[model samples]
Target: MKFFKTMFALSFITALFIVGCAVQQPVQPIPDFSPTTFNSNDYVSALDNFLIILDASSSMDDRYNGNKKFVTAREIVKHLSQTLPELGQNAGLRSFGHSPKVSDKLTVLFYGMEEYTQKGLNEKSGLVSRAGGTSPMHTALTAAREDLKTFSGKTAVVIISDGQEAMGLKLPITLEAAQALKNQMGEDLCFYPIFVGDDEKGMHLMEEIANIGKCGFVTKADKLMTGSGMGQFVQDVFLTKKPMVQAPAPTPIVATPPAVEKAWVVGEAYFDFDKSIIKPAGFEFLDKVVDVLKSRPALFVKIQGHTDSIGTRKYNDALSLRRAKAVKTYLINKGIDKNRLSCEGFAFSKPVASNKTAEGRAMNRRVELYPVTK
Candidate 1:
């Protein structure tokens, strides 16, 4: 009777409540994009190294879209790692403002400056599982300087965060640290800050930090969630196309050999910090240069040495000269006529990229080879 009706009503309400509670917004899926497979003959590595700075601050604990921002950030990094082609680039991951579950420290270089591998990066990124601490971004940036201290060549710093600081009190200090890293690394470094969440302030802050490197760009996590977007971002930051060299078409058999275009010109050679000794990669490249010179006895080469904006002009001038001489000596040993090889040092002047970033500085610290036909 009435009691039975009451029980029925209560049961119906309970069932409705349970149903309502069970219904949840479906998690957004990570979209697919064509995966890039890098071919050494067709493409070259753009960045020699990269470091990812992830924000595990409390603000990232807040929900964004359908999930916690921290979860989204973690997935983004993992996806980015997968999307990145194995380019022999050095990679590292640093997480800041994470809870005890993630790490006891305020910041941790959880991954590497070691050779990049998708599985390694994804596993390390997953370990940063919780977010519950004050944002100490400045400390992370300052630490990044140490993380990349020994790495040479072009580097990219990827910051994935909601861009919120602890009460915004340390924002300026964080910016200063980023600037210091840029100044320390010079043209050899760039920043790619990926903003998570929809906070307008966070987006702006990320943009400013990216601007500090002068060469990087700011992106949103939503955009990067898609496969195509991630592919483009990874390619833009990590790769450059190899110059296309067209071979001559076959002709009728002739007694005389056909003249060939000068397709074997060497571009530039890089040096290690403060050292004129050729690096292993430099030796391989210079061996190619030796072949080109041997093929063209009528050609003379002008080797111009340059240095980054690190030391005094006088010291750099001497260093640059030494680097030039090192290259000249290599050519002579390979049996190229020393009389046909001329070299000069430009010190820290005539920069190809801004001396304010590590990658730029690396570019400046090089020897340009110009081949002239006698």
Candidate 2:
């Protein structure tokens, strides 16, 4: 009788363990925000011709967040190139760093979007040689404007640098030059100055330029590069209608099918704060998900979005959904069937880590994608 009791007790404990493993709290769904929609064929005055003027001055070699300014700028350009197709945009490249004299002429690394698409651009072969000097912001802008004159479509000039103008040209003068170009090119021409590193002077100058050019100003490099805010900004600038650009069309939302047996695949996708897009490093893990999907043809996955308990729940929820859908869209673009994937947002309700510290919050704000057997 004692042996029977022992066996029964063991079985009870085993059953509890199995039940514990099986029971999972339902993850709160993230709120979905309406995204902007635009007609693909409409001539909405898009800046199809993007001229990137990189400040390759010696000062750009300074380190920010453990990476050199020039290096970070390069990576940002590469990211834009890879992601531009999603927005139906294209870009060209030029730099002032190759000049031997501080006043030397700016070098055109890549002429236009067509060249960028056909030949491809690389740091070693395409970037201006590291013959560093002062930043000739005015010269670079003027040269870019001149190069863009022949092109008929809308044009945008983006300057990426630490804001130190090599030619000793005043910020006001540079602003005037950009404005003059805008006036010449008509209101369709936009100027965007992206200051690398946390230089107050450069940021201020960029703000002034954006104002004068009547364009958008992006200050926080990390945030501007990664997150939903950035995605929205891209949509506004390229896709939206009205005086303000509209958001991109929201991804389709599907109800969870009762017949499907779901299995959670959770992992953290890190991003710079106040941003909703994935970084280049995050893409490697996404590649793994692609591999898994390729191997398991019978399984379908649902992506759950989460965020650190920061901002209001409403905002977090919306941001989380955007991030999750962004991942799903990326996967689909890589050839995954759209029908096999579903995404939902959980916001800050599912906190895997404390939001008290930056590192913890980084871990908490992530997109979890797992397989479900239907």
Candidate 3:
């Protein structure tokens, strides 16, 4: 009887061990699909025509930060053209620096969006390689305006230049031509200038162009023209619905008494050129502000919007307000009190950084948050 009992006990123990092993089977992890399809067609599409005007002037040959400006611009244009879904929208390519004759002026490299049936950007064969001369930016603007004349949809002209109008055919003539074009086009078309270098004079020219064209101006290169910058630009233009403007750098935070009755958090949020909506990556930082407001139940925040010295002051001012309100709304949705927040737009009147370099302009486009404790 004892032997039989021992056998039963051992079998039971073995069975329990087997059950334990079965229960210990590893849990398979779910593959992350966020990065893969983050920008996929999950949201409603806002299709718009993109005209990429590249500055292929010899000056573009100059190294910016490290890479050649022209090369970086080409990479950005090509990637956006290929990756962004067709959505019934087309991309046009033009250049200002390459003319068979120095006087030929800004040449149309690729006219409008055509089906991409070729390999690479055809660097050696395209007008980019063939273009080497003075930059006729104004002429390029005129040509771009003409190109958009036929299309009735939303048109955006993206000029990627080093911001130097010095070597152009004639400065006064070009400026006059651009202004005339703007007068003819009215507000139907948008012009966005992405200055590549850090020349103050060049940035001023770009700012002038933006003012005349009533569009956004961006000066800077982020992360070597990888898809992120392009994506940010596109998102800013379409999603946020805020017109682009140049702004100043953020002011330093001043020390104040902790018992100060009230304070207002005011700041502007910067977006990619021609883009209005905030990128997802920036959401975390923005959310922190909301969290702070939630923690301080008695504190009220006022958001002030500002733009760099670009585009019409009226438009920038309005856009700045809209951008600030957008943030306020976002915070409200995140559980902050709407009544506690107020928004104001300052336009290009306030500038913290010189709008000369690409980096400086980026610093200009931002939202200011102030706390009001009264």
Candidate 4:
């Protein structure tokens, strides 16, 4: 009886182990980030060259918030690539971990120290397949120092990692490497470290590395995954706001005839699908309109909102009105008199472009400004 009981217990234990091994944790889906188009007229590239250091060490295979850290890190790079405007800057991507199939080296430069393009960077980022091997972050940084040497301009070093290294390893080695890179690049080098996990030690390590660069800031992967978050990050890293030139003082008054009635369709301002918020790309056009309105206080302007024919008429009507009001509110906040502005919503009634194609739909979702003689 005792022997039978022992056999049954062993069988049960074996079954339990097999069940645990068979069940895999489901990875969460990364939310799609709608990148905002940045107008070149309002900003210029801040850095001449930039390098992205991604961590693909074995540790990244571990899951954080239901998704593998490696996947999240890769997504962050892709989204950043999409958000960054092609302003003729040099770019490169390096990975610390070895994917046995792709490379046998401890570190590899996957992409350019060449001119940056949204498509080119994304294709190279996709080439980094699997994550395996120890974190040799110091070695990657050392190679990156050499990578930066090939180009001359203000540069940014963006490191994306979980901040965890091999057990029993001394931490100072990583910092020393970062410091050395900084010493080589001098004031032109900035460090932007993106922490990928919730590990406290990892966060601190990433923060310390950024501190060493002295010119950049630290952010988390989850925050950068969002559309607005990535947009702000890109704006901070790559572009500097062009100084707003003040309108020249009005010339001594020569009596001018009443301004001819005019209408301006701000097709230059494009809206994201199903979104009503004014994008940064649209701000420059609106600011010019603000100058126009302020200069013509006697003119009453009508703000017209339109939308693509995707939703029901009733829903599109409300959406369009909300869009109109959004522009109206923006104008009011900019010190335009509320009494002079009126809003109207034309929901798919006016087709500036065909609703069948995406390009046409984007053009359809726009605001028009009409100035009337008071």
Candidate 5:
């Protein structure tokens, strides 16, 4: 009995010590909200051209939870590139603290000012590896200014950072560089700064950077972890359609002619990513299309299926065809004559929107209904 008690006491003490050690680790608090999807296409018109200025400083080595700050940042940027609307605009990726030994070195532009492609952006984003040395954020910003010297339209300068200035640096030059860039670009430039970790000073610094650009805004990485949050961010940035105020004078209404032109706008049936089966909402949409097709029996309907630019052309071609078949089957089940529904898979060949963007790709990945009048 005495031996058993002694062994139990020792085991209990060992367990307590182990538990204590585990408790000493820093705890990363979970965000208030989390949702699954944050597809970038939902917010289409954020910017025509932009650069993702990623911080690769030594500070990113710190752990937010179990994951490194730099790792989280890389993932965020990768996802951002994947989802961002690619409306055939120029975009690029630039990194700071990549070359620590070289002080005078400018920020490296791994991507482009060329037509933005999701795959290209992702490849560039992945180029950033381990973080080292001081944060040369201002220098990076200056280099970015130079990079955009040739760009004419409104540009988005997106900086992802922990907000730490260069090591042992006294006065920060971020605001100065930002102002310089703003002056050069005028109203045509916007700055969006995202905080990678919960650094109060860093958040403040980022907010200041955002303030420098009248058109830009500040955000936190955590805020966009969930799909809904990401959607909200995209909406605020892209879907920039302003609300209309009621005018004192009402607009005049025009009456329609009895004989309308054969020109019919058949709304698109959108497909979810890699999905051929129509959703409940899509089915409802098809109901209206069915009615239109039934009313105009003389009109032959063409169902063209298309895929986004993510997959190989051959694979996408097959996928696109499957989508068209799915739509055709759905329509046939809904009492539409098989002869009236002619389906064709255009794949990614004939894209209405640029495949470089999420929204553009979303627009492209659809079964478009066009009335064929021979």
Candidate 6:
């Protein structure tokens, strides 16, 4: 018995020596961030309230492209933190599959649902040192109900994940949780999922999750690999793109009198009663507007959305804005430059006709296009 014990001890000592000889590389320090070199402020955030849910499960430690997935994701998150346009949004950072187990209380809020800043996010992101535990993304989604319960206006939930939930993970619960969040937030909520690697199944699952929210879409993680790439992603997901305004096109027909001319207005476009839906005739006219815009490339146009006064001022304003956006979307679809088009919802505030009668109200519900001087 003593001889056998001695042999076993010798074997253990040899194994320990071998393990100690193996070198573990130190984690590389993240590159220093330059705000001026990477800032994107030309546009503003689209969301009034937003949250970033990062995946930190063990799977993230796996390799992707060349580096570890977790490191790549963390870098992307850091870049986004630095790149997000400040639009007075209440933003928070949450992580699931990070705790020892999946639990309601395990969903950790590192930053806040408070006013967002790049510095604050960078600090919060530093708290996540490594990836461990199983992914409980559903629990994280479910937790959003409480996190965004009080905030109002357009909300965005940006989810970054490799998209692979743990085996036997509660995926159905995730779908259900997403639906519940939608029901609670209504049209105010949007989901933008970012995939870290080429996992088709994981990507599809994320796509389905985004579809449940009914807004935003699935995007690849590598899109934020560089400063310019990161800037573009921030602009796409967060910033509200500004219209590309240029100097007004010079009139070829020089009149003898140098008098100011009124801006061109497309009066043929009309919206239905109490609705923002544009008519087929309106679509056709907008196509002509597109042709003119294409022809006069130097000019920017403003889309004025108006509504009948049948509804409250607040309701009318929103409806008119939707109508304006609808018109802008049509013009964009017809190959018109988005940067050259701007929209302003006037609601019942700007009425060309009387709102006391049906005929006048019908005329009031219309969108007008006006040329903008540079």
Question: Judged by lDDT against the true structure, how good is candidate 5?
Answer: 0.71
Clashes of each: 17, 11, 40, 0, 5, 1
Evaluation by TM-score, superior candidate among 4 and 5: 4
- For candidate 2, write residues 1-374 as lDDT tens digits: 99999999999999998898676433333223233333433323244566778777778866676666776676556555443433334556778765464335555444454433523544432446454666667776777667777664456677777776655567787787777778777765777777778878878877777787676565455644563544555455544222223222222123222222544333434644446787665565677677767777887888888876644344466789988898898899888999999989987788777777665776766777777767
Please name the candidate that would achieve the greatest lDDT relative to the true structure: 4
3 or 4: which has the higher lDDT? 4
lDDT of 3 by residue, 40-97 (tens): 3333223345577888877887766556666666665555554453333545777777
Give, for candidate 3, the lowest lDDT window spanning 10 residues: 29-38
Per-residue CA lDDT of model 4 for 1-374, tens digit only, reads: 99999999999999998898777666788887898678976666777788999999999999998899999999999899888988778899999875788678999999988989999999999988888888999999999988988676578999999999877878999999999999999887899999999999988889999999898999999989988999999888888664454222222222222243756665445565556888665676677778888888897889898987754454466778888888899989999999999999987789787877666777778877888976
Runs of candidate 5 exceeding 4 Å displacement: 1-44, 99-106, 239-374
Off by over 4 Å in 1: 1-34, 168-170, 246-374
Better of 1 and 2 by TM-score: 1
| Model 4 steric clash pairs | none
For all candidates in order, the CA lDDT equals 0.79, 0.63, 0.61, 0.83, 0.71, 0.74
Candidate 1 RMSD to the correct structure = 10.9
Candidate ranking under lDDT, highest first, comes to 4, 1, 6, 5, 2, 3
The better candidate by TM-score, 2 or 4, is 4
> Model 6: per-residue lDDT, tens digit, 1-374?
99999999999999998887664344565555543243333443466788888898878887777677788888877888777756567889888766354333457888898998878998898787677787878888888888999887778898889889889876677788888988999987888888988888788889988998887888788767777777776666666543234222222222111111344344555665555777664555566667767777886888888876643344466788898898889888888879988989987778887866666776777777776657
Query: TM-scores across all candidates?
Result: 0.63, 0.47, 0.48, 0.63, 0.55, 0.57
| Cα distance off (Å), candidate 3, residue 353 | 41
Q: State the displacement of the C-alpha of residue 152, model 5, in Å, after optimal TM-score superposition.
A: 1.2
lDDT of 1 by residue, 1-374 (tens): 99999999999999998897787555665455455455645554577688999999899988788788898898889788777767577899999998888678989999997998888998998889899889988889999999999886678999999988888385688899999999999987899999998888888889999999999999889877877788778778877654353222222122222233332222334665566877555566677677777888998888888887654454577789988888899989989999999989988878877877666666667776777787
Name the lDDT of candidate 3: 0.61
Q: Tell me the spans in candidate 4 whose CA falls farther than 4 Å from its real position.
A: 1-24, 247-374
